[model samples]
Target: MEILWLSEEDVKGSLSMEGTMEAVEEAFREAGRGTVQMPPKSYLIYKKYDGDLRTMPAYLEEMDATGVKVVNVHPENPGSGLPTVMALVILNSPKTGAPIAVMGGTFLTNMRTGAAGAVAAKYLAKKSSKTVGIVGAGAQGRSQLLGLAEAFDIEAVKVADVSLDRCRALEEESRTFLDATFEISTDIKEVCDADILVTTTPSRKPLVKDDWINEGTHINAIGADAAGKEELDPAILRRAKVVVDDVVQATHSGEVNVPLAEGLIALEDIYATIGEVVAGKVPGRTNEDEITVFDSTGLAIQDVATASRVYRTAVEKGLGIRLPFL
Candidate 1:
């Protein structure tokens, strides 16, 4: 048997915002319909290196897509000229449990996550939302903006970060695709004044205060993938309609994890899962004045779905190297 090997470039060449969003959206629907099997992520902490490795496995029954992603988060890797996060996804044939493809998952991770945010905003954010705010100007932040531009007719973009260089770089980079006027600031609250607010920082404490959020705002809480990491104040979650990618996962490591552990909120405070909303089991954004939040912990089903899409495309295009295995 030969396993197809797809590099990051191959994956990037095959992905588009629209295609990824479609794939990821369908995966969420499958999750809502209970047609997917995704175990909570398992972690291996490397305290000595200040990093952690996580394994995510999933099988989408209807789609017959199966994959596992091995990812790592090392915040200090930039100093060594490496990305802060890197991943690899291996797609397998659900029929016989044979590995079909192995592809670089870092870019897939960014794109799928951004697609998840866009899907959440599509259901939760108002249709008239024109302005977007991004709190962390990192890889995830850039991807989120890319997905948002595809989902909404964005008029203005506000970005806040510690480094002026990163902020301006995002603005300049966005000009190639995004026509919106870009504003860069170091003030996180200044970026909060928008129709849609996205917080992607890896902050242990709340960077966005409760009062900073206004009425009718839709927030995509993209950070806090692990325990003890939080970006929004617990109060923000308390009053808003909180939707999670996965309820049990969110309660353990998503944005609500810290708050739940501290007793600031309870599991009952969650409004609904994004999958349910997409599946039409629950309504999204009943009124214009209601605040909404999508707590995303990132799902393996997303990776599996997107990886399958790429693998199919690669095979059709005669791309990727097929190496003999066993």
Candidate 2:
């Protein structure tokens, strides 16, 4: 009954971006084949504060990973000296249903979410893509940028944020992490022309107009994960080859959530889950000129797959504080 305590640093040390990407690819394959056991994520919404808590659980029998993540999205956290999001993961031994570890999940959530974005781009983005645009220069923005770079030979990155300082900070930070040059802009449209576009702001209204997107653009909508949040016009979704991490999750909480709720777009309009493309069940990026949009709601299978990779790494490297209770 040992409970392992893993800090953010330990988790970072235990996981590799490359390894997580491989694991996520497999999860997408299993999910596409309907072999993964993942119920829709359950959420507890609060009306007074306009906050939300989500509990996501998944078991991949084929991959032997099982975990439940409890996360919160409080938009006011930055003003309150906290992050806008926080999470914790409880990893369990699927064989005996024994709890194996409790680890900080903020990093895992961000990295895996970014991994999903990269996975999407791997399938949907044009092979010759090099330039990237990022809307929202926060933590998620950085993750998305790095993830996108992992999949492309990005030569430059264009970024826009409401805060010029944040945008500049992202530019400065990129010097150390990425080889690409960065350009900061106050105008959202300036960033929209990139071959790969990522929207990570938690905007409740559309920010990037539909017309701003040109042909051959691949958008990773990472911001809109709740019912009211939206980053792009529904018309953009209607015209693009819309793919989601999970149809059920996206229908309820992803970028398409509000559009679908309002009858602006039908479920049939969705071409396929990103997993389908990853699994070879569907083709991706068939045409270089087609617009592709990947709606990322952050799948539970990502957590299971990512956590399993982290756990295995921790075991092999002797990375975490293992308690004697087991």
**Model 2: lowest-lDDT 10 consecutive positions:** 15-24
Supply the TM-score for candidate 1.
0.99
Tens digits of per-residue lDDT for model 1 on 207-315?
9999999999999999889999999989999999999999989988899999999999999999999999999999999999999999999999999999999988888
Off by over 4 Å in 2: 324-326
- Give the clash count for model 1: 0
Number of the top TM-score candidate: 1
Total backbone collisions for each predicted model: 0, 4
lDDT of 2 by residue, 289-309 (tens): 999999999988898889888
> Which residue window of length 10 is worst by lDDT in model 1?
311-320
Give the Cα lDDT of each candidate: 0.95, 0.89
